[model samples]
Target: MNNQYILLPASPLFIAFSLIVAFVLNLMPWGQMVGVPDFVALALVFWNIHQPRKVGISVAFMMGLLMDVNEATLLGENALAYTLLSYFAIMIHRRVLWFPLRTQALHVLPLMLLAQAVQLVIQLLVTGKSPDWFYFSESVVSALLWPVVSVLLLAPQRRAVDRDENRPI
Candidate 1:
């Protein structure tokens, strides 16, 4: 098989497990912070970058729904945000993946903000008021944590290079 076409080394089980863990993290009590880092968004970005086919917009939408319900926010508030988030992630996935993890954090920052922006827009439209800057703290927190999230999620999926003669096809 062509190297470029070689499947990414992620398993379905790992993907599901990571998303579940992310959702749990998002639901954890955070003591009335201005904004909390969204583990679900981070995990969505990671899987969408590495395995877009298996996990993409639909997964993000569902996760967003769960987030909205869990957080008792406006219905579809996070779903819309997550949908936008996954779209942007899929758009630049290949280029972002080419960079080192820390550098990828820089690239993902805007997308994180955009996702939050979408949420803010929806909130504003529904309430006829704009959210303050603190409403975006979650994006800042999420972007800052991107590299760490990448490392943690990719740890189990990394594969050693096999430089010797090719083994069985």
Candidate 2:
């Protein structure tokens, strides 16, 4: 059976809170573990798709700048990557919303890959050193996490229960 939910409008405070939380998660010292997903990218993509008006490229750029400062990389490396990610997510958000959660994950995979690719390219151009093959694994993990991210991010906006009676919502 199909169990679609009618989500309430997302709160701006909650959106900011979620993005901050994602940034904090990224700040955690994971010691460069391979396949460690970028929580900031995942959250950015989710919000960009779900609420394009609320979370746009400026937000992505700011977050990316924060990430660059935190990661000690060249400034604007992550800004460019995340700006492109938000742009791409916003571009196809309508079509993505038509798919099932699992299928949506498939669509998100490429966006994550694209963001990573942009950052990787910038890093290569600046440092002139190539990363290991495992560098791409982060996108795969982020893609695998799309469903979870969707559920968590949308939780605050989801209707608690469906009305079957006089509430024609």
Cα lDDT listed for each candidate: 0.85, 0.92
Worst 10 residues of 1 by lDDT: 1-10
* Best-fitting candidate, scored by TM-score: 2
**How displaced is residue 159 in candidate 2, in Å?**
2.7
True-vs-predicted CA distance for residue 152, candidate 1, Å: 0.9
Q: For residue 137, give model 2's deviation from the true position in Å.
A: 0.4
> How many steric overlaps does candidate 2 have?
0
Model 2, 1-169: lDDT tens digits are 4456678999999999999999999999999798889999999999999999999999999999999999999999999999999999999999999998899999999999999999888988889999997999999999998988898888777655665777644
Tell me the number of clashing residue pairs for each predicted model. 0, 0
Measured with C-alpha atoms, the lDDT of residue 49 in candidate 2 is: 93
How high is each candidate's TM-score?
Answer: 0.84, 0.93
**Candidate 2 overall lDDT versus native:** 0.92
Model 1 lDDT at residue 58: 99
TM-score of 2: 0.93
Superposition error at 27 for model 1 (Å) = 0.9
Clashing pairs in 1: none
